[model samples]
Target: MTPTRARYDAVADFYASGWPDAIDDPASLRLLTLLEPIAGRRILDLACGHGRITRELARRGAAQVVGVDLSAALLERARAAERDNPLGIHYIHADVTTWSTPDQYDAVTCNFGLSDIDDLDAALATAARALRPGGLFVCSLLHPCFPGGPNVSGSWPSGGRYHDEGWWQATGELSSLRRQVGANHRTLATYLNAIRRQGLWLDELSEPEPSRDWASGRPDAARFPVFLVMRWVKATAQP
Candidate 1:
């Protein structure tokens, strides 16, 4: 596992404990909604941490569902969950940056995992390669702007240097914000451009609504979008 994913594996237990905001997380929900899988279509859940949506896809009647992650710790938990249902989900522990899949899936999804990936281009390329022509590539990531301010570094009035807001960054414990924890950060433009480079045509862009609970308790949560959802189709070089 890569250093970033490994870090998440070590902390996988925290998420399973019912990440307080799990139900309110719009990123994963948006991706799942866009997938719209048929009962027998093959689906790939790239970087499926703890198999949350992975299980959902299988339950929704996908013919084959595969969840790949770089962290063994999280994969272990995913495996445990699969054991209960035994729907035959293939769990792979590998880095998406280098993994490859032939034209094997009707759809590929990356829910809240793109921004954390180091090689965004390679990852998108892999997703594109894995899909048959005209197949869909659905993914969600941190909004390039808003919510977290400018992801810049500067000195605050408190007289200490600190890293400011950034894409795909979350603050955890000790008033410290961790950037690029399980994945790296990328701008919205960068994402679109990368998908194009991977022979995928942008189809739609969506921003999911934060759950009612989150909006009520965290006023600023909706003010700044915390997630972005995108749908793309494989390009066919035809007139």
Candidate 2:
């Protein structure tokens, strides 16, 4: 297994219990808002952890929903939820970077998941291929430009600059999840350029306002964007 998958597998139990079913974080809320009119849309969620957002997609009336992840323990939790709640969300045990499907989807989403994936280009290409022509590819992530303020770790290591893109683990209390599993850091341009390369056109971009509690706690970090939400579209023709 890849380090990312193994690292997360080690922490799957903690993660599965820690996060509530109804997520209220600003980043996730912003992403959900952009996923409107979800009644009957076929959706695929990449790097889906415990099926939180995937369940949300199903709950919001997605016609069919599939969630793919690399963690076996996490997939078990997701499958358990599906068995208990019967949301019809199919959970797949696979990595987003290498997984394939004959079926395409109307919309593809990755909630704060891209940064955790080591092969950003491969993952983006997979997402692109999973989309039907003119379908939507939407995602949210921790803002790369966020220079951390007091107590919080920004998008990169404390010693690392924003332009320094690679893998690093956080040590801050605010970065509980990342501290355990680490994350991949990439520049905004890298993501945009890769999306373009995959024939996914940028449709909308959002830098959501930080929550009052977070802003008050880390004013400096709040000064910069805390989260990024993007919507892209698969073109009818590829380059």
Candidate 3:
């Protein structure tokens, strides 16, 4: 198994149980709001942990939804949810960086997963190939410019270089509920360039804040962007 898969497998249940609260967070709410009118669209959800957004898409009227992830343990949780709720959502055990299907989807989404993928280019290419011409790709990620690291100051430490790749462990009050995971930190230009290389066109970008209740406690978070949401569309014809 890939190291990322193993790491997620180790914390699958914990991650799933705690992440659901994020569904109500502003970034998530904005993503769902942006999806708008999914009555008959087919969606491919990448790195879909526990199928929270996958099941939500199906519930919101997506004609068909398929979720792919590297961790079988997480997919198992997703499957259990499907069994009980019956959203007709299909869960696949696969690596997002290399997985492909004979079929294409109307839309592809990855919620807070891009930064976690080791092979960003391959993953973008896979998403582009998985979409029909003119289909949409939407994703959210930890903001590259201000990714929270060891410091709680809400600022990149003065004179400290932003490392592009590393293993990060969560600590303090939330330590038990989180895991030390591998992550890639790319600049805004790197992400935009990757999307362009995959033949996807940028359509929208959003930096959403946490909800009032959550932000109230961490006021410093409001000063700098925490997450980034982007919407891209494939071209009708390759150049």
Local accuracy of candidate 2 as per-residue lDDT tens digits, 1-239: 44244567899889988876887888898888887879899999998989999998888999999999988888899999899999989988888888889999999999989988888989999999999999999999999887777768888888878899999988887767888888888999998998889999999999999889978877777888889999999999856
Task: Itemize residue pairs with steric clashes in candidate 1.
Answer: 116-183, 116-184, 151-165, 151-166
Q: lDDT of model 3 at residue 58?
A: 88
List the candidate numbers ranked by lDDT, top first: 2, 3, 1
Model 2 earns a TM-score of 0.95
Task: Between candidates 1 and 3, name the one with more favorable lDDT.
Answer: 3
Off by over 4 Å in 2: 1-5
- lDDT for every model? 0.70, 0.88, 0.77
The TM-score values for the models, in the order shown, are 0.82, 0.95, 0.88
Candidate 3 weakest ten by summed lDDT: 149-158
Error of 2 at 94 (Å): 0.4
Candidate 3 TM-score, true structure as reference? 0.88
